[model samples]
Target chain A: MGNLRERLKAFYADYSFYILPVMKFALALGIYVLINNRLGYMEALNRLFILVILAAISAILPFNATVMIGIALIVAHCFGLGVETGLFALVLYVVLVLLYFRFVPRDALVMLMTPVAGILHMEAVVPLCLGLVRGPESALSAACGLVSWQFVEIVHDEIAPLKEADAGMLNVLQSIPASLFSPKLLLCVIASAAATVLVALIVRHMTTYTRLRAVIAGAVLYLVIMLAGGVAVGVELNAPAIVAGTAASAAVALFLNMFVYSVDYRQSRFIQFEDDDYYYYVKAIPKMRAGGAKPVRYYDDSSRQNGTGTPVNGQDVDGVDFKTKLEDSLKDL
Target chain B: MLTKQRLQLMISLADFKQSHINTTMRVTKYYRNDYVAVQLVKNFFVTSIAYLILLGFFAVYHLDFLLTNMNNLKMGRLAAVLLIIYLVMLAVYSVITYVIARIRYARAREKAEDYDQKLDLLANIYREEKQSSGNPFGEDQ
Candidate 1:
């Protein structure tokens, strides 16, 4: 596990700039495919050529700009379905924007995860992961993301109804209350998310447990929450499937935590220092590194040795010796 | 609102607000308890707006149902109840955070005091070594 984590860290450090852009492009493509598959807006918008272009552009653009483009795509798709659907989507978008600015403007990750989690039906993972890695406040953003996912699903549901109904705007608007606010579904999603957040927060505060253990606990808690929440809300759930999916998500979360919060378990050092009147106690945690590397030494052993090859104490080395020592250290590395 | 002085003041105030927000956000890196409180306050306001919007949508579409049920529903009373619930939750969260912060502070103070004692002992040992060697520079010289 340690070796794999080291390799992963090295790989990330070496190619993160390139890997991140490619990952963004892939995420954009995935979103496009999911949206197109669900909405089936227009052939022009759904074209492979257009999606590739959009994904490429989104990958290079700033996160906020990318989110704006995503919003625009959702709007366009909704408009293609019906005017009322478009307006409803606009309202959802406005609410999301308000929530984003007011609470979690920095949380682009949650915004990206919303559609992904919704489509995958692994919504619990978002809250669980956020609670472990982020503060309790991120729970709001995770809930917002889930809500946005539901909003999109609601918009999608409206498409068939809007197409079938030849009635006026009032009649169409009336249909929204039932589809838009299915209290049972909303309750289930919110309850599961809130439960996950609570479990994650509790696990995070368990300083005695390893992060890996905490992540596993979070995943198990998520599964328990979903099962209990589903039963309480009378929501139909494929229990075995959810269990399997959440377990897989938990495994992924554990792997991610390993890379993100890697620490050397054996190398804890305590030291004491003083400056004038004040004293400081420091517990230094040294990160685990690959075995073949060594820290650079700046002082020369030769400079600290006398003419008869005996070690001289408290000898100050000059700049030339220091430069030689640094070069030698670098060469050894 | 469009006056020159007003505009300048508004810009300055906006700048100050932005800087303040940035500083507070950075504080989360060092202080988890404070960040949790800030997040709770922010989430409360944002979620309240979202809930209100959802309610507004439902109320606008189902005006007749709301009107008929108004006597039993008592919207103002419900709002007051929600406000009370929010306040209670906030108070509980604040108290919990305060306790955590106090414990952390106490632990840090204990560590500092321990370090100070160790530092004093080390200083005394160094003084004894120097005196025994009969040189102010000690054995290293």
Candidate 2:
């Protein structure tokens, strides 16, 4: 197991330079597809060749720049739906960005996770991941992301219903309040995300089984909150779909923890040492070993064989012990 | 060709750079320990306020439905139950954060102290070396 892990780590280190760019490109493509499918705005812009080119370009850009492009695409989609919708989205996003900069500018990942959560339908994974890799303060960023996602979703839904109707500025503006105050949508998004964050925060701090257990607990909490909130808001529940989605999300979360945040539980060490003036107590935690190639050992047969078939010290040639023979050879030299 | 003013300016610049590095290190240390707790508290308040505002917006806009729901005793009971759950969650979360923060702070302080001791030892060694070499800086004095 250790050898395999070492080999895996070595392989990752060797190929990460290539892998990262590929992953980025793939992620960009996925984001483009998601937005195009979700909004169908800019049908002309959604040509396969253009999307591929844009994805490639996005891959080379910095992460924040990529996110900006993605946001721009979403806004373009909103504009395709209606000018009022697009303007409202732009204003909302500007506000979100300002809040992000003013409070937690470092949490760009959480901000990105907003649209991802909506598209993936796995909002629980965001908090689970953040709790593992970041501090508790990341919850604020997650909340902001959820709100942004909900806002966009509300706008999309409202515009969808009025697609055939005359979607003038006034009509679009009139529909905003209904979408904004839709108790079911707000409650489900907010409550589920908040519950997941709370679950992740508490479970991740536990001494034993932190990441895996947090993922499980977080997924459960998210489902419970979503279901309960749905009930409270009089929304019909889809039990089977929710169960399947939560299960798949938990599995993905587990896989991510294994590959990204794996730790060796057995290699933990506690040491006590003393210097001239102070006693030092240390707890050493070992990270998971990456899989690597097994070491090969070579032996020289001529050294063990002294011109005679019999081995050194009268031991049989076939059963000659290497350590004893080497020691004898060294002593003789 | 180097003037005294240029030398003095160079020395002051070096001093300023060194002080800046030291301040950065100190700030990083504080952030890794004490600032975590502060950030958690701040996040809690900000997230709570944002949630409340969102919920409040919905309630105000849907005042008729909200008032009708509020008249139901079941709604009050449900709110109370939800509130209790939230309170319990908060309590647990606080304890966990406190414990983790304390451990991290202690570890960081220990590392800082060890680093300081090593630095002091290095300084002592350098001083001894200078004295043994007949004090090159002392020659100017």
Candidate 3:
């Protein structure tokens, strides 16, 4: 009974950080489907994959303000769709995020990444793994499983009707000839970008330089690929390519980074880095210091006693005398 | 099920906020020795003023372009409808964060009312001082 209780506790502990985010992801998706039966499948699918992976990361790391923000902002940024489509999506994302850290378990890294994670959804790898994992399963099964979670169920039962009414209200709002753009929308974008920077600053507080470097490198690569694709496809930076390119770039960087780590890590720690059919430059050094590998046999003294050879201390040394000393030290006891 | 963990998490957040504020106060005090603090405040003031001016200026500058864009989109009334919906959503998100943060602050104040481990450490420091010099005050000596 005690063991069973402990198992249950562990299970809850493991998944606590993710439950709310995943549920929110589903709620946002459900609303998307309701609004348009033929919802652009690319962005929603990509977001679904990322949601699962980040869910895993959040589960592993300790919960904190940083991680919560990271988790929330990312889910919102990805699935919220375009700027226009994102308005409602963003609200659901924020509420779910708040509820998670409030009502669920948050890991330490989540706390560190909280600020920027939401707006930017900075971790690019979420989609890559999700693609590899979820692509095999039926979309309906995946969607339903996600939607059935407690948070999604709550939204369906409680929030959906209210939102449906809002949708009707939004329809009425359409009749007005008001400007398409408003300071409100522009401010929101600027605010989100600022939030992205803010979250990144907070992330820098907890994460190491190398990981941070990888993150930035991944970002640049993602943008380049996305821009190239956007130009090629004549689509203005769509979700499918952005997510696909970013995920691919991050995976490549994660692999190549092994080659960039310090030699001491390779030698002492014994973590084998694979770059098959590749050769790397190694600098020859005179001595091993600070966790470096000790040289095999570099300590033989050439100076020895010649009865005439002068020594700084008491004894004089010559070549043969040095050889004798070496031999003597090496002799078996 | 979430009750126990929730309480622990909230208390932890309160502890974190208090320590962070204290650290910020100490660092700011020390940093005041440098002229950077003066520069920082001046820069903040200048930026805020600049942003305020631009906020009004840009509101008028882009107002025409935005309305035209809205008029161009032929999505019936949905386009205009969604814009209002977006504003309402933003308002909701902002209100929720502000209220929760305020509530957390109140909870933090209540948590601080109990005896803190900081007091015990300070008492130890006082005791050590008493041993070095026979009590400095005469009333209880």
Best model per DockQ: 1
Q: List DockQ for all candidates.
A: 0.16, 0.07, 0.01
Q: How much is B117 displaced in model 3, in angstroms?
A: 6.9
TM (chain A) per model = 0.72, 0.72, 0.22
What is the TM-score, restricted to chain A, for candidate 3? 0.22
Identify the superior model by TM-score, candidate 2 or candidate 3. 2
Q: Estimate each model's TM-score.
A: 0.58, 0.57, 0.24
> Candidates 2 and 3: which is better by lDDT?
2
For all the candidates, what are their Cα RMSDs to the real structure?
15.7, 14.3, 25.4
- Tens digits of per-residue lDDT for model 1, A163-213: 666656656667765675676457646654664566556665444344566
Which DockQ value does candidate 3 get?
A: 0.01
1 versus 3: better DockQ goes to: 1
> Candidate 2 residues A88-153, lDDT tens each?
667566656643544445566455566676777765666666666666666677777777677667
Q: Candidate 1: misplaced stretches above 4 Å? A: A157-162, A165-168, A206-209, A260-288, A292-333, B1-60, B63-141
lDDT of 3 at B123: 47
